[model samples]
Target: MGEENNQTVVTEFIILGFPSLKKLYPLLFLLFLLIYVFTITGNIIIFTTVLTNYKLQIPMFYFLNHLSAMEIWYTSVIVPKMLSSFVSENKSISFSSCMVQLYLFSSLGASECYLLTAMAYDRYLAICQPLHYSSKMTNLTSHQLASGSWVGGFLSPVLPVVLISKLLFCGPNQVNYFYCDAQPLLKLACSSTQFTETAITTLATGLIFSSFLLTVLSYIFIISTILGIPSITGRNKAFSTCAAHLIVVMIYYGTITAMYMQPMSRFSLDINKVLSLLYTVVTPMLNPIIYSLRNNEMKHSLTKFFKQIDKRKN
Candidate 1:
């Protein structure tokens, strides 16, 4: 009787992603397909370029390799499901499958946050304290930092997933969005979400806010050091190196903050979905382009890479 009673309370969720724009489905499908292909290709290229180019074997490129890897998984976590939703009439995920998606997506997202922080600190040491940079960010230290980011990122989401698993699902099983997310999953829990929400919020705050603060602080010091340069050319050159990092940081953090920090009531559900898409899909697609376009080293490496390929072909 008790189990039956609990089952009656909740069943599933209705995911209303991109709300019934029947006309837009075809266009949206093609657009997202292209975006996914580009995102995968771009990140793979960056990862390969960094690995093969002897010049890019430094700490920064090491971090870039991990970031590219994260981007690959991160974009994969949401985009494929989203694209499928556009074409398929039935948008449904099994309870177990939803949990898996949630776990992997949140894990990758948290990992990227810490990875970005590590990258920022790498830049800080390189730019602001070039004298001690080599010793401070030694190969061993870089390996440790990179390993920590991956481990920490994986651990951060485990608690929430465990907590979520304890909840019962009774009736409404439809998740309104293309993929599983914490917010949507929370809404479907038959049990009270007070404890789960509080726990997830605390973890997110610690992971996102702390990493963001550290990155911001590192850049502040970095900007100050760049400003201290006496020569205009020197300052310009210095700022250019950091500019790509800053731009990507702003776009990523800005969208994330906008999406997660706001009260649910303020925005429509569709708006929330769009914002989520921006951060999860659009940003990953843009990272390599933003980083490579402004980076002379990456461009040079890419050119040399293509030339080498051409020589081998001939």
Candidate 2:
């Protein structure tokens, strides 16, 4: 059935990115440029802060350093090209380039989910199993956990992305959005996509579900232990550390849950585009602010570091 539909394979695709706002493209470009600047600078600050401060050499901050590093690549996967599209009359992306974007976007997104789970587990150990936390999350173990997230993230999408990219696209050459997402790519394929669709679905489901479940379970244990504290100060202190993590988890997972958890037939392109913006753009920009500003250690470190720079200048 699929072979019959093949006529001519498309070599490149034109992206109709945010076509609804044609008149406002310049303004949107400025907005995106500003966002990219802040996202890059803020995440870099967190990454550098963690590296420079010996006091932050613990597992929690170690994982955070990796998260900031991941955010840099995560948003970079889409934002740079999307930013280019706003100004360039030609928004066409070669088929290979589109697949690369798809792969990186998916890989980094998966890595973040697992990284969040890792952070939640760290909090669980710190709050629920304080004594064992030190021995359990040793420096080597911290490196291993951080490495595992990156490895899992990059590897998870390889097979699916490769398989999907190889699918014949003797169809329309215009993708109605900025990036080449899996579902949109599959829709463009001239071949039967049931198998590819099933594979992508299974991989995505396993990745999102497993990480989300672990994060939820870890938080349950953390909250239970926090409530068990005898004094208000003790409870507040315990909750305070986890509060930032929880806020981040909510923002990250909330958007993803809305985007991915929808039934396949019910996926509205417009809605997905909006939700994608939330996770891919907004969340990356907000991470450093949420994690750094809310935590006492980060505030103190950044304040002192800036003061030192000022003194040196004088």
Candidate 3:
């Protein structure tokens, strides 16, 4: 079936990202530019703060450093191209470039999902099993978790791309969004997409939804433990530790769920594009804010660092 379909299908696609809003191009460009700036600045601040503040040398912050790095690359993967699309009338992506974009985007996304899970587990140990928390999330163990998250994230996209490469693209090549996504690519394939679809869906759901479930479960135990704390201060301290993780988890998972957890027939392409923007574009921008605001260590480090810079300038 795939071979038969490939004979008649098209080879490449034109990306129609934000196409109908020619009048709003300038406004959209400014908005996205601001987002890109904030996202990069915020993540960079956290990265530098973590590296400079030796007081923050713990499993939680260790995982956080990796997460910040991922956000930088993740946002970089999509935002520049999106900004270009707003300015360029053509909005075209080559066949090979599209696949590379898809692979890198998927890798970063998967790594983020697992990184969140690792953070949750770190919190769980601290809250629910305080005695063994240090032993369980030792520097060595944390290193392994962080490394695993990155490796797993990169690996998830490999199988899908391999499968996609095998298929023929002989039809309409217009991708409706700013970046190359698996579903959009799958839609443009000239051959039967049963294998590609199943593989992509399985990997996406397994990496995203399963990781989400693990994070949620970790939080459940964490919240329960927090409530059991006898003092208000103790509970507040505990919640504060996990609050940043919770906020980021909600935004990332919520957007992803909205995009992928529905029936295909019921999924609206417009809504899909909008939801994709939330996770791909907006979430990375918000991550640093969420972590910085909720974390006192980060705040203190940032303030001290800025004060040093001010003094030097004087």
Give the top-scoring candidate (lDDT): 2
True-vs-predicted CA distance for residue 120, candidate 3, Å: 0.4
lDDT of 2 by residue, 125-172 (tens): 999999999999899988888889999999999988988887988869
Name the lDDT of candidate 3.
Answer: 0.85
Write the residue-wise lDDT of candidate 3 on 27-89 in tens digits. Answer: 999999999999999888888888888899999999999999999999899999889988887
Model 3 regions more than 4 Å off: 1-12, 263-265
**Candidate 2: clashing pairs of residues:** none
Candidate 1 lDDT over residue span 55-147, tens digit each: 999998899899999999999988887888788877766667777888998888888888889989999999999999999999999998899
**Best prediction by TM-score:** 2
Candidate 2 local lDDT, residue 183: 66
The TM-score values for the models, in the order shown, are 0.93, 0.96, 0.94
Better of 1 and 3 by TM-score: 3
Best to worst by TM-score, what's the order?
Answer: 2, 3, 1
Q: Which ten residues in a row have the lowest lDDT in candidate 3?
A: 259-268
Clashing pairs in 3: 9-170, 9-171, 10-169, 10-170, 10-171, 13-173, 14-173
Of candidate 1, the 10-residue stretch with the lowest lDDT total is 6-15
